[model samples]
Target chain A: MTTEKINNISVTTLANVYFDGKCISYGITYADGSKKSVGVILPASLTFSTGAPEIMECVGGACDYKLPGSDNWVRSEAGEKFSIPGNAKFDIRVAQGFAAYHYICHFG
Target chain B: MTTEKINNISVTTLANVYFDGKCISYGITYADGSKKSVGVILPASLTFSTGAPEIMECVGGACDYKLPGSDNWVRSEAGEKFSIPGNAKFDIRVAQGFAAYHYICHFG
Candidate 1:
């Protein structure tokens, strides 16, 4: 699989990375294509399908995830990768200057 | 028309509201279905069709909009709405700790 950069970010082989405003989730990808998740600060948990075209999750504490399709955001915590299909419908969440994360999805 | 409240917000007859981290755009809904937009703090501009269901936009800065999908956030400034269909694809942008906005979409 190959990765492409849209806004100075590298993404390929979609995976969910978790964080908690402190530590990040251990990196892992299943060969069977399932969902991977972890917890972070603010007692937040993230979950997503390791399946092609990923879907990630996050918890809200005054910040959240931001996807590619909306005007507002879903609340999120510090550490977690929210993955979704490139052409899938989704949103992004940020806490404004206190936290932010990046994501990438692949479709074939 | 009537309004519905979810997560402590009232949404009805979907409309686009603009803000600039200072003054919000004049509330208006054209009789004709079209996009309504304005600018805010970061020299940002938001444009979206004021049509049913609703899709808003926001420019990026240290902060941005946060939609209902994804784990990470796209970049955004203050005062703008990034709207999308109830089941459409999109992303949100926030700057963390500095700002955040709310959104609601009705699909009937």
Candidate 2:
């Protein structure tokens, strides 16, 4: 995960309005209108829908995931990244039992 | 954790220059003189010396730690923050077995 902080950029948090306690993410915006989010996903299987093209970067633990139209689940580990197109959905499962998946979601 | 990004700041990465593969942290500098870092610590018992005051915020997992002169270990969970004085050495241990410790380090 990238840890560089720019001088002019501010960090904003996102409210957890959906999925209650299972998932949480915060939103960040760049000066040029680019946006990013960092959040944690607890152990569970979930399907997520995205409205914008998103690049998800695993920052802490590994997660097993199956993208839209795929039946095979692939594992994504820390320091790795994957992309999902806008209007698409993804199936993600965190099977590490006690390990919560930490990630950064970048909007394109 | 705050996830909002400002428009003017740039993200930079830090080279892992020490401790081999046990611990890793990335340095992020604000537009001002302030700096921050986000990293993950694998399971281990380590003692570290710091040159500046640091506010360590837990982001993903829990850690068992004994600061400076204390003999007792305390548990710090995700979303909690702890502070260490400059030039102080503290002992940190991660016993979660598989859960890596993720954190944000703020300099003062």
Instruction: Report the lDDT tens digits of candidate 2 across residue range A18-50.
Output: 353356554556666666766666677889999
Worst lDDT run of 10 residues, candidate 1 chain B, spans B5-14
Question: What does candidate 2's lDDT look like per residue over B1-108, in tens digits?
Answer: 432222344434222322433455545566665667665566678787889988888776768778888888888877888888999998788874557666677787
Q: What is the TM-score of chain A in candidate 1?
A: 0.31
Q: Which digits, one per residue and each the tens of the lDDT, describe model 1 over residues B4-59?
A: 11111111111112332221221212234332322122123333332345544332
Worst 10 residues of 1 chain A by lDDT: A2-11
The Cα local distance difference test for each model comes to 0.31, 0.66
Cα displacement (angstroms), candidate 2, residue A60, comes to 22
Error of 1 at A90 (Å): 7.9
The per-residue C-alpha lDDT of model 2 at residue B90 equals 86
Residue B18 lDDT (model 2):
29
